[model samples]
Target: MKNDSGAVAAVKARANIAEIVGRYVTLRPVGSRLVGPCPFHQETKGSFNVHPDKGFFHCFGCQASGDVIDFFCRINGLEFREGLERLAAEVGVDLGRARSDPRAAAKKRERDACLAMHELADRYFRHLLGRDEGRVAREYLERRGVSAEMIERFSLGVSPEGWQGLQTVLRGRGFDDDSAIIAGLLTQGKNGRTWDRFRGRLMFPIRDGGGRVIAFGGRVMGEGDPKYLNSAETPIYTKGQHLYGLYEARPVMAKTRRALLSEGYLDVITLHQFGYGEACGVLGTAMTHEQAKRLSGFAPRVDLVFDGDAPGRKAALRAAQMLLTLGGACRVVPLPDGEDVDSLLHAQGRDGFEACLERAEDGLNFCLRMVRESYAPREIVAWAGEFLGGLADEGLRALFIPRVASGLGLAEAELRRLLSRPAKRPAPGPRPGETAAPRQPAWELAPRDAQILSFVVRRPDYAAHLAGAGAGELLGNADARLFFARLAGLVSDEAEARLTEPETAFWAKAQMEPPVSDEDAAAFFEELCVFLHEARESDRRRSVMDAIRLAQQRGDSEEALRLLGELQALSGRGDE
Candidate 1:
C-alpha cells in the first residue's frame, strides 16, 4: 500500500531532520539536539526536542516521539503513504508506485494527462507572447512591474484573440477537443462547437500545492465586462481549494511559518519580486474554509493585505472569521483607502509594506473592532457570543469574557449567560411605506453544543467511544452533524486519515479548547452528553411553544389543546 523502496529511502537519507522540522518550528541548537515549540499539539513552553543527528524527534510534553517519516505525518496531517509521496517529491525522488497498484496507476495516468495538457498550453501561451498579437498583454504586464525574469520564472503567458487559436495547436498535437475541455483549456459553444477558453487575455497559471499547473486565470487586456475570468471547476482544479502562488510561496512560508495573502495575481507577483516571497493570493474568490485550512497547513498565520476599499475590508473580515473559526491564527494589515498591494509595494517598496505588517492586529481583535463599529450596545452581547464562543480554551475564554463585558458595558455574569445560549439574528427592517414585521426569535446552537462537538473533535478516541453509545444521534447542530458523519469514517483502530477541508476547519475550531486527557475522559464525556441532552430538550420545548402559538392564532382549539398536552408532558406537569 506504500512506496517502500528507492524513493522513500532516498528521501529519508537526503532529508535533514533539523531543516525539515525547522520549516514549521523555530529551532535553536540545544546541546546535540534542536528544541522548539511543538506544532502537533498545543503548548506554551517549548518541550519538543529534536535530535538532528539521529534523524528522530520527541516531544517531552505530549510524548509524541517520531522519526522523520512520523514527523511529516503528524505535522502535515497525512498518513504514512501520503507523507512518503510528498517527501519523495520534495527530494526529487521518483515514487514508481504505479507499477504496484492499479488504482494508483489509473490516478497517475489521468493526472499526468492533465499535466501534459497544461504544460503544452503554458508553452503555447508563452510563445503567443512572443508574437505581435501579445504586444498589448506584454505592455500591460510591464506597466504592472512584471519583469522579463518574473515572466519566465512564473511562466506568464498570453492567449490570442482568435476563436480557435489554441484549439488549432492542440488538435495538431494529437490532443482531442474533449481532453482539452476536461483539462479546463477549451470551451464548447451552444451550437456544438469548441474554441479556446481564454482569448485576448493575459494568462496566469494556477498551480497546485505540488507545483503543477492545474488551471488558468485570465485577465482582459482592455475594457471588458468580467475584467477577470477564471477557469471552470475541473477534476484537478477547484479555485477556492488552491492559492495562486503557493507553489512558489511554499519554501518561504515553511521557513517563516507566515504568509502574506493578497487579492490578485499581480499582487502576489509584485510582492515576491520585491523580496516578499511569502506572499500568495486567493484564486478569484473570497477566502474559504478550505483555503484557510490549506494555507494553515504551511504557515501558522496568514496576514491579509487587501485594498482599503469597502469590499476589501469586508472580505478581510470574512477571512478573519473563517480563520478564527478554523483555530488558525491570522492578522489583518489595513492598507490605505484606494491602494492595493501591487500599487503600495511599487510606490513604497518592502519598507512601506513592512510598516503595514507592523500595525497588523490579531484576527479576533480585528473582528471585534468591526463588531464594535456596526453593532449597537444591546446587540453586542449576541455578537460577542458568536465571536468568543469559538474559543476552545476555557482559560482564554475566561480572560476575554470580562474584557468583552467591560467593552460592551455589560456585567460578566450576564455576558456569560448570553454566550451559553444560541445567538439571535436581528429582524428584517420595514420597507418604505410599510409597517415593520414583528421579529420572531430564531433558535441557534448553545455554547454547550459547541463544547460537546469540540470535545469530540479534539478527542477522536472519545468520538469513537461516544458513537458506540449513540451519542452522535443526539447532535442537532448542522456543523456538528457534518463533523460526526466524517468522524464515523475515521473510526478504525489505526485511523490517521486526514479529514476533508470543512471537517478540518471544524476540527481546527474545536482545537481552541484543549482536549481532555484519557484519565479524565470518562467524567468529561458523561458531563458533555448530559449537557447535550438538556440542550436538545430545550430546543424541543421551544418548538412546541411555537406550535401552540401558531395553532391558537389560527383559532384551532383542538390543535392548540393537543400541543398544550404534549408541552405539559414534556415539562412533567399535569394539565389542570
Candidate 2:
C-alpha cells in the first residue's frame, strides 16, 4: 500500500503468529499451552512458554514475554510493518495495499518516493562503476582481490567527482532534503549547505535479513585521506551489532554450521565469491559481544578470519577470548603474514582456502600454543598461571589443565602447579562469587498488568471493575490497553492470537497499529496509574476534610464535630 491510516493495522490483519513461529522452532503441547526453548535468549531447558489460551509467550528464565508478533520482531529483527506483512501472509488475511488516512497515506507515498530516489542514486553509482569514470574505484577493488561477482553480489557502486550527483538524482525524483536526511544520504554542512554523506567512493548497500536497503558503507577509491565511510548509525543500521554480509551469508552459515567472521566488506565478498558463502564481516570497529552473539545465534562455530599480520592476529585473539567465554567454538584461522583474508583467498583460490580453513585452530588451543611459542619456559608458566585464574569452573579449568602440560612440555604436577597459581583480585574488583543480585522478578506494574490481563481476559466483566483506573490501573503501559482491546475483538479462528503476548512489540504495534516504543509506553502507563491511585486517595481525604470544616463552621456540637473528624479519618485524611 502506498499510504493509509493505521498502516500497521492492515498488515496485522493478515499476519499469522502461529504459522511464523512454527517455521523456526518445533512447538509441543503441554497442558493448555505449548512450551519450547526461547529463541531471543539461548537456553537448553524450555524457558520459552507459549499459552494458546492467552495467545502469547513468556520466558520465565529471561523475563522475556511477548505476543506472537513481538516474537517475530525480536527473532527475525524486522521493523513493525514488515513483521505485519509476514504474519498476515501466514494467516491469509487481506491487506488492501493502500492506506485510507489522507495524511498518513501521503506520508507513506512520500517515503516510497524517497526510497525510489535512493534506488536511482544506486543505479547511477552502479553505472559509473563500470565506466572510465570509475576506473580508480575498479582498480582499488581489483587490488584488494574483489572479483566481478563480488562487486555485483554486494551491489558495489561509485559516487562521481561532482558534489550534486546524488542530490540532483534524488531531487529529480521529487525527494526533498527531509527525505535524504531521513535515509542518511544527505548531511548539512556548517554553512547550511547540504552534501552527500558518501562521495566519490565505492558504495555497499547493507541490507537487513529481509534484504531491505537499510544503509550503506563506502570505501574510498583514490588516496584522499579518510578511507572508509559508513552510514552513520541510523534507525535501520546498527554497525557494532551486525555483520555486513550477514543477509547473504546466513543461509550458508546455517547450512555449514559455521560463520567465517572477517573485518571488512570486501573480505566477505571475496570469500563468498570463492565459494566460502558462509563468510561475513564486522564493520570498522572491534567486533562486539552483540555481533559475536548474533553470529553464534546463526551458527555455534565461527572461524575468525583476519589478516595474519600482527594487528590482525591481535584482533583475532581478542575475538577468541570474548567469543570463547560466550560459549562456542571460536576458531582462529591465521592467513599468511601481511596478507588479509581477501588476498590470501584470491592467491590460493577456493581449494587452497578450504585447506587453510581445515587448519583453523580452536580458540583456547591457539592461544595456548601461540603463548608458549612466543614466551620463555618460565614466562610460559607465569602466563599460564595468570590466565588460568580466568577460568571459572573446575570443568572449564579441567578442559585446559591437561592441554597445558602437553603444550608446555611440562610434567602433570608442574602444569597443575602452574595452572593453580594463587588467585588474587585486582585492587578494585569483586572476589569470585561476587555476582550481581540474581534477577528476580523485580518487576512492578507489569506483574499487576499481567494479572489484571489474565483476569480481564478471563472475565471481560473485570474490565468494568477497573473503569476509573486510569490507563495505568490496568497494565504496565498504554499499549497493554490496546493489546487487550485487540484480543477482545479477534475472531479466534481468523486472528493471530500469538500477537497479544505481553513481551512482544509486534502485538503492541498491531493493536495500536502505529509507531510507539512499547518500552516507554509500558513505563508511562505504570507510572501514571500509580499517580492516579495516589491522587484518588488524596481526593477522598480532601472531601472528608472539607465536610468536617463545614460542620465546624456551622457551630455543630462536640459530638457532631467528633463524628465528622472520625469520618474524615476514615476517608484517610487524618486520625480522629
TM-score of 1: 0.64
For 538-559, candidate 2 gives per-residue lDDT tens digits of: 7676776777677778877675
- Alpha-carbon lDDT of model 1: 0.74
TM-score of each: 0.64, 0.63
- lDDT per residue for candidate 1 within 1-576, as digits (tens), equals 011245555777887788888876778888987888776544455788887765667776545665576677666544566577678778777866455556655765665677788888988999989889889988998888898878887889999989999989889888899988888889988897999989899999988655678899899988995888998877667546678998888788756777899999999999889988999998757876567766775666789998888788778987887676555678999887778989998999889888898999887777777777877876676667765776656766787788777765668888877667644533223323234434444434456556566777567666666776667667767555645655654322222333433444344444435557876778887876686678678888899999999999999999999999998888888655
Candidate 1 — worst ten consecutive residues by lDDT sum? 490-499
Query: For residue 548, what is the lDDT in candidate 2?
Result: 68
Best by lDDT: 1
